[model samples]
Target: MSRLERTMNRYRSLRCSGIADELQELVAHAEANAVSYLDFAEQLAEREQQVRERKRLAGNRKRAQLPPGKQLEDFDYRHQTTITKRQVHALLDFGFIDNRQNLVFIGPPGVGKTHLAVGIADKALDAGYKVLFRNALELVEELELAEMKGELKKKIAQLTRFDLLVIDELGYLPMSRQARYTLFQLVHAFYEYRSLILTTNKDFTDWGEFFHHDNVAVPIIDRVIHHSSIYMLGGESYRLREKTTAG
Candidate 1:
């Protein structure tokens, strides 16, 4: 084989798939442009870097399981007046994840709580952080199953692996003793170490009712909010607005 073909094979073997795949096209572009050797090398390196970044983000998105097409840009701040555009833009910077902080979005149903959470989560995903989006019931059920299977530790370890975890629709269902304890344990596992974004329809005062009592609720709320930034959203329901406009 030719020397260039051999080099391409070497790049492939080195796991530089980007360079290997774009080798010929880049070389042709360099030749057509009559670029200097230094410029050609820079272009090649830049292309490989871009490809690697794209792959990294693609893998992050796949692992995150973020909702498709739910992005910060699409969030209707005009309708979600409580969640200000300024605050949302600030979150897009994703410094909270770096600081290992928590974000809580509390509001009634359909007030764009999950949308904002998902939007922040999308930004987190883009910012090179591992993210997971699961509803409160789903998370509780997983914890319950883990306890039943005697795999609670392992599950907690896995859950804590993500840089950010977005738990949506919290308090929509009442928690049993096991579920409440499990939820507490899960939060405790990640507390002060990783970031979490929670969206719930219930207020902090109503958490006792949602968790079924005050005694078990104190530690859970304390740990989560002790280091959290709470944004109490108040506004008309976005879903209703959409439906009304469509009608």
Candidate 2:
């Protein structure tokens, strides 16, 4: 075998497949440019690091289950007058997550609550933080099932592993007593330990009615709102307006 082929085999054996894959092209470029030995080595290291970073982010995005195309830049600041571009841009730094603070977006349906929440979550994923997105009812149901299976603690532990948990469309439907209790336990476990981003259609006053139990709702609200940034989005439903205009 040629010397180049032998060197590539050595790289692969050392688990530097990223460098190995680009070795031929890299060697050619280095020789063509008369690049120093140190510079050539640095280039190889950079290629391997970039490849690993891309793979890591791809895996995290898959595990996050973020809705596609919900980036912050795609959000329409014009339609949702309540929140400005500036306010949302400030969150890009992600001090809230670092401080273990929550972000709660409250508004009527289709007013872009989910968009903003998911947008922030997408940014968090790009910043290398582990994130998980779930519809409120779906998350509660999973917890309820886990409770029945006596795996509630294990399930909550799994969820808490994520740096940020995004719960979308909360209070769209009333929860059952068992479901409410299960959800409360999960939220309580996250208290002061991890961060949460919640998009809800119900107000704080209506939470008691939505949960069907004031006793359960109170503590959950207490934990969620403490050390949280609350944004109230108010406007007509974007979906309805678009349908009307289309017609």
RMSD of each: 2.2, 1.6
Which lDDT tens digits does candidate 2 get at residues 152-193? 999999999999999999899988999889989989988888
The Cα local distance difference test for each model comes to 0.89, 0.93
Model 2 regions more than 4 Å off: none
Candidate topping TM-score: 2
| Colliding pairs, model 2 | none
Candidate 1 per-residue C-alpha lDDT over 1-247 given as tens digits, one digit per residue, 9 for 90 to 100: 9978998999999988889999988888888989999998898788889999999899989988877767778888777787688887887778788888899999988888888899889877778889999988988999999999999999999999999999989999888999988888899998899999999999999998888884779988988898789999988887888899999
Give the best candidate by lDDT: 2
Q: After superposition, how far is residue 223 of candidate 1 from its true place, in Å?
A: 1.0
TM-score of 2: 0.93
Q: What's the lDDT of the predicted structure labeled candidate 2?
A: 0.93
